[model samples]
Target: MFSLADLPDTIPIFPLPGALLLPRARLPLHIFEPRYLAMLDDCLKTQHRLIGMVQPQEGSAMSAGRLHGIGCAGRVTQFSETEDGRYMITLTGISRFRFSRDVTGFSPYVKAEVSWPDFQRDLGGEEEDPDFDREVFLKLLSRYFEVAGLETDWSNLEEADDELLINSLSMLCPFAVEEKQALLEAPQLVDRRQTLTALMDFTCRGGSSAPDELLQ
Candidate 1:
């Protein structure tokens, strides 16, 4: 297990319902709200201005919002302050964090003390499978795309690594709140991919059927 002591002190915290971040990928955030602005200020002053991206259970602002247990910490690699005092920030994920507890007495954004797991990444092993399972996933994803009438760069998507592909799709896909939470709480890349595959299959089948196969 990865220790909390190893994490950088004073990490950045982004608290929003239904948003998830995964490691080794980048997420762009538009920051205009006051609490997040205050968070940006606090991060800029610290040595490790890294931020943990988490989803709150309740759809409220800082007050009365409950954070989910899992999150990913990212470093602000690129940032631009807009003319209107808004910030367009790019967060590049560093590691996945499990919430140890929440830190209070700060601004609107809630900070969590976290612990991480020891994971080894094999960056060169990405591949496209033409088997039945992969075919089903692809077909489901296509249906999802058509249903939502969304356009994406298929070529670039086909080239993404497993973690990036699954997590990015999970974040952007029009899935339910519980479904998104499931994707966020999945322990590893393999498990997450499997869960996503199941979700896609169910969605493609057009059923709100119980996720019996997946939950098992």
Candidate 2:
């Protein structure tokens, strides 16, 4: 239940590739690396318990690669420490942020200053895709799933609400990293649905997985 005012100007960032966390969606992460473990420990002591989930882009000389410009900030809602000393946590997406610049520091993990003005809607409650056509979308999804050799419970997807179904699919779908980023950057629920549908359709048509071609 974090309001816009509760969000911080800076937060610890976890730059994971192909991990897409949209607003109001939930992302479960396993923290095993020493730096991230330390990051999690520090986050626990804070009131907001927020972490920026960003994706690392390719073609970077740095070991962690260059981070994407935009990322979603999620609050640690559920947390548990495993017997092996790893941290398992579920981050409920609070909002998407525009990455300003990295804050150089002694901290092992990356930290950055972020702004949320561009995505004020992310702090709002669940959104409805009024234009969503479930049956058609599902049919397209079935074909895409079949082509991709993926399986799922049709009943569960059908039962989910508009936001849940779209966000879940956008997160779980085996699309390319940049495609996932495009979905994350989509301006609205309807726009996300269209982007997702286009990606699936492109894949179904035996298109290349290259992000440039897929998005174009």
Candidate 3:
């Protein structure tokens, strides 16, 4: 369990469209840009070692882009710096937060005041979601993979626990920004599962009326 006290009142955000992180999920990031490299340095020096992973809104201007309001905060766990000054870091997520507003002038990197009430449940370990529709999820996933011509280690996927399987697939799947936001904002694990189902169904069927799956 993460202590709320360890998190800062505000967090510096790294906004890369299509990249995402979720509570308890680990995301590998390449930090080559000067601003983010500086951000990583400050994190290593200060105890405020959490970075908020967010996405710039699709089709938005890169120079002065708008970000999706919700993002997950990740704690720096693995870090290594290359001779060329680039940093390869892995962030293990701590919790999800909603942006209150952007606050600037404190750092070269962008900063945002954020609130965590929506994701307090994330501080605790994820319990097995009784309502998870594993059969449907797998069926749609298999079909989606077939459509995309993507391959997976089926044996490894089968061995994953409920939380790992869901989070892993959600991260790996190339769902649209709106769909990804739906997964992040789901109120509970079961809800996220349902949202994943909807997104997968839409993607696999070319955004037609959602294809129905056998319910068990």
Candidate 4:
């Protein structure tokens, strides 16, 4: 069994993969799944059900439903109940966590004790990447859209901040699973930016010659 001895006593957790929540980000979630609904209810009652967003491993029965080791913890900041019995909620990321242990409890969702060592932004922190080329990113993204024949709202794209722009594109770009995992596990914003540039370049080139390969 895993242990929680080294982790913080209280932390809200949402263990969902394919969802990456970063600080200062507002992720809109459609909460219709029952297990996750229970998790939301628990969070509503507690006022801070921290969620650790991570991806599930591929082809591993033992780790099938469990989360990976690394994730970001998001707090349930805004919530409303929809007429369809679904929840329209927004999560504001607080910290990045490492799963130390999974708590066996009555809750349908698994809880992991986590540590937030790299949560804060500082001089040496991952947030210190200053050379992000927004103009270059936008040009490449525009070319990518044309090559793929995609329709998007460029107005919204223009106003997004660095994190939102990068993470949003990363989230929706239809990249490979392993590629998405690499983006998620990228240690710094600067590194993520670099990866985004490289991926965009690949998409632009491969998209023109072989659309299938670009998508793959």
Judged by lDDT relative to the true structure, which candidate is superior, 2 or 4? 2
After superposition, which runs of candidate 1 have C-alpha atoms over 4 Å from their true positions? 1-6, 58-65, 106-108, 117-136, 208-216
Decreasing lDDT order of the candidates:
2, 3, 1, 4
State how far residue 37 of model 2 sits from its true place (Å).
0.3
Models ranked on TM-score: 2, 3, 1, 4
Which digits, one per residue and each the tens of the lDDT, describe model 3 over residues 103-127? 8685778878998877778888864
Screening candidate 4 with a backbone cut-off below 3 angstroms (N, C-alpha, C), the clashing residue pairs are 12-50, 13-50, 13-51, 14-51, 14-52, 17-54
Q: What overall lDDT, based on C-alpha atoms, would model 2 receive against the true structure?
A: 0.88
Query: Which residue pairs clash in candidate 2?
Result: none
Report the lDDT tens digits of candidate 4 across residue range 107-216.
77666676766544411222545787778879989988787678789999989877778877777776654466666667678777777677767777773222232223
TM-score of 3: 0.90
Which 10 consecutive positions of candidate 4 have the poorest summed lDDT? 207-216
Q: For candidate 4, what is the lDDT?
A: 0.65
* Top model number, lDDT: 2
- TM-score each candidate: 0.80, 0.95, 0.90, 0.78
Better of 1 and 2 by lDDT: 2
Query: Root-mean-square deviation of each candidate, in angstroms?
Result: 3.9, 1.7, 3.8, 5.7
Q: Where does candidate 2 stray beyond 4 Å?
A: 59-65, 210-216
Local lDDT at 50 for model 2: 93
Instruction: Report, for every candidate in turn, its global Cα lDDT versus the true structure.
Output: 0.68, 0.88, 0.79, 0.65
Lowest lDDT block of 10, candidate 1: 119-128
